[model samples]
Target: MQFTSGYGAEPGAWRLPGANLRSYTDMDQFVRYAQAAERGKIQLLFFADTPVLDVDLERQVPHFAIDPLLVMTSIARETERIGLVSTASTTFNEPYSLARQFKALDVISHGRAGWNAVTTSDPAAAANFGRAVPPRAEKYERAHEVLQIVQALWGSWEKDAWVLDVDGKRFADMDRIQPVDLQGRHVASRGPLPIPPSEQGQPVIFQAGGGGYGLELAGRYADGVYANPYTIEDGQAQRQALRDAAERAGRDPDEVKMFAGFMPAIAGSRRAALDRRRFLDESVDLRQRVRYLGAMIGLPLGYRQIDEPLTADQLADAVPSPHDPRSARALEVAREGWTLRDVLAHGVIDYHPVVAGTATDVADHMQQWFEAGACDGFSLAIDGYHDGVDAFVDQVVPLLQERGLFHLDYEGPTLRDHLHAREQYGLDPRVTETAAR
Candidate 1:
């Protein structure tokens, strides 16, 4: 499972701010967290973004985090080897600015940066962006167009575009760097972006939309996928589907890595793990529980009971995860009576999987899934405060290293180099340059 640092607003943490990070009011604190994770040889540091604030998560949950990109900019200067990922929404932001920001990050980080492509789904985001309501099918189309434009911009400067011609008194060969005449359906542009292609070419693409169109688009282009994995069997099945889709889309399936969002709450003993699990289950407020349940089942906000029997239809309706309106997810949770506590307790099942146990046990589950080809890795979305990340890095991570399942130290300087160390960087050099119009 891929570990992600969100959900908590933790204070007094050394490595990462816990899920509830409301207490961490320091800007430099985020930098400290990223630096510490790098010391652990953690592979990737990721963040997610929303165009607008909705459901009053801060009022509901413990804390709300900062802008992922800005935080990563600080990380770019302070850390090395650890892959830095930023989440950006194509729905609200323009492609040009988004492309430029990610490119600049890639350059400053020495290619340790990646962009998680997303479509803004929150209703409040629509309001924030001058839309009365969210657009459904159109958003995916816009994302596709945005991806196309961004890639072209990244490729605008050819490998030899900036050869200095001192004798000729020229800075670059204009012929080598050409505009990309991209007439997008929703988003379009001309480019050879102001910045040349960085050492890593461009930041890697990470995707998480689970719908068919989103999966196909990601399959065609993304380097990694951030996904929700319930069971090992389910993850394997999803992996297979992604592989098949890649084949159909005429891309190499191996090019994309899977980082399932998982919540593994580790403890020294089975009893301790269980106790921690219980505390988490009972800790959440009850109304939030109803909202969470409705969200999960894709039902509208309404009445539900704790002991209410879940129906096949209700469960089926809720099973389809919503990408845009939190309302759809909220409705499902409430109508089905999936309380906040249950939502938190289920972890990866209804929630992302939360593994609560000793280091050995937690590593065992991670290994089982890895060897099974269910996922390449997991992004941990551990519970609040600092204990969750602390235990993971100190306990579970060490075991993974001992088993040779994870890296004891980073192999390369760049995120792309580290992720695909043995792979060729110029594998698609020709794909990098399209003549300017």
Candidate 2:
């Protein structure tokens, strides 16, 4: 199965109970983490970025402080096999510029670069770009256009376009270069990208979003998907839905790999792991939890007592912010006439399924999900900088390898090669073609 390290250096990442790691801002720690992941043969080191500050700056880590692509560039020289994926917003960036940057990264990394496509969701980012936030539909519409233009630009230079002929005094074949004269309702671009395609084609595209619009975009163009499925059943349904959408889009379903998020708190034994989980869970302050609940519901719940039962009227008064996708979950709970404590009890707010156990126990859960066709692999969410990742690499990876559920060594170079390696494992070919049936 494909393995990706979802670097958790952002604000709330450090707030988990029992977390004693240093700040993610420490470059030394970050580099060490990347090296450890590479040693474990993780396929991708994925970074989640925001164009503007969206969280409480005083309480949370500012994600925008460092540009992910630049950081990836630094890591590129330190490792050879692991893939580097960076997030870029179609809403805030022009297609041509984004294309050029990724092309450069792909070249520098020898075709191991990936771009995580995102239409900026934080309304505050609009101000940074000096514009009002567009409606959700409009943002996605623009994103679709942006993607087309970027792909066109990346294809502008044909293979073998570059010819260094000393006798002819020629640098490139003019006939082979073509302009991408594109004009759509939301975007327009006319150009041939200056950079040619890297050794492995354009940087692999990764996309993440919630709801239908997001899924449709991923189905149409993404090579890999960072999905949010909180249950095994939910994961199965989402994977099937993505494949169905791919069929309708006239794309090969197997080409689109689905990666569900996973965070494991492992120890020597299952009981010890449970104890660690309890410590971490209890470490989270009530105020912070209430604030998170407010963000999910799109309104503050600070005034209400933690144990107070929420009324429909109170919920109805608190309208969901158009930008936050998780607001739907809070609304669902409020509609059920549940108490504030119920929201905390269900743990419905987390993006991924958390598994707490021994290495074998964790491996068993992962095996069950994979065999059940829940996802192509997992994007591991780390709790600590060094300790968290090191534990899994040392303990969990060997178990997965022993079970023949994961790769023993580097299969091939390039992110595309790593993603396509799944075909060799005898996965059901029909998994991606389920929509046709």
Candidate 3:
């Protein structure tokens, strides 16, 4: 299965009880972490991004303090094979500029670059862009238009467009480079990009969103999908829905690889891992937890007591208008009768699948998911930067390889190459071909 090392610091990550991890500001730690992921032959080092800070919650490190592309560029210099996937928002960025930046990254990394396309969902991000948050429909409409222009610009130049012929005094085949000439309601581009395609064509497209519109966007164009399916059944259902959407979009379903986010707390034994998980959960303050939950539900829960049980009436009253993905999930949880105390104690804020176990135990769960066709791979969202990453790479990866569930070594030097490597394990090869186009 494909693996991506999620490199970022979230709330309670650095300040976890009894934890001695370095702060997110430590560049040396980031570099070393990338190296460790490469050593394990992990496919990508994925960086999550946010456009602005929401003051309602507190975090030790500022979210989006360092630009994701800049971070990826620095990491690119340190590692040779692992793909560098940077998040960029379609809501705030101009399509041409964003396309140009990703192209440069792809070239510099020798074609091991990917773009995680996102429409900034936070209201704070809208304020940073000097406007109020647009309606959900409008944001998605803009996103679809932005992606069209970006892809068109990337494909404007033919493979053989550039020619260095000093003898003939010709620099490039001008006729081979066509203008994008795109015009949409939300976005537009006038001509071809300044640069040609990198060794592996354009940077791979990775999409992470929720709800119907998000799934449709991913199916239409994304080469990879970053998803959050908490159970095997959930994963299987989501994967099927994505495939169906791809078919409806007139694209090969296999072209889009769905990767579920998995955060594992690994240790020498399952018991030790569970203990560490408990300590980490206790690190976050009660206020922070309430605020986080409130954000998910799109309601104000900061006034609520942490130890108190939430009534069904209160949950129903808190249901957010417009019904965005996260809010819908929160409503579902509330409908299931989860109380405030249960939410806090069960670590519900981190919604992705959490597996705490020994190396063998972790591998077993992963194998079950893979065999069940629940996901193409997983995005490894470990708790700590140094120790968390090292533990998985050194211990768990070997076990996965021994079980024939993961790759043993690099097959090629590009992100596409790593993604297509899955075909050997019974996936259809046509998906890679369609992705290359």
Candidate No. with top lDDT: 3
Q: Please give the CA lDDT of all the candidate structures.
A: 0.66, 0.73, 0.74
Which residue pairs in model 2 clash with each other? Answer: 11-61
Return the top candidate by TM-score. Answer: 3
Write one digit per residue (lDDT tens) for candidate 1, span 226-253. Answer: 8876667779888878877666665677
Give lDDT: candidate 2, residue 37: 86
Which regions of candidate 1 are displaced past 4 Å? Answer: 1-25, 61-64, 132-135, 164-169, 274-283, 287-350, 421-437
> Which ranking of candidates, highest lDDT first?
3, 2, 1
| Clash-forming residue pairs, model 3 | none
Least accurate stretch of 10 residues (summed lDDT) in model 2?
A: 421-430
Report residue 99 deviation for candidate 3 (angstroms): 0.7
Each prediction's TM-score against the native? 0.78, 0.79, 0.80
Off by over 4 Å in 3: 1-10, 16-23, 55-59, 286-349, 421-437
List per-candidate RMSD values in Å: 6.7, 7.4, 6.7
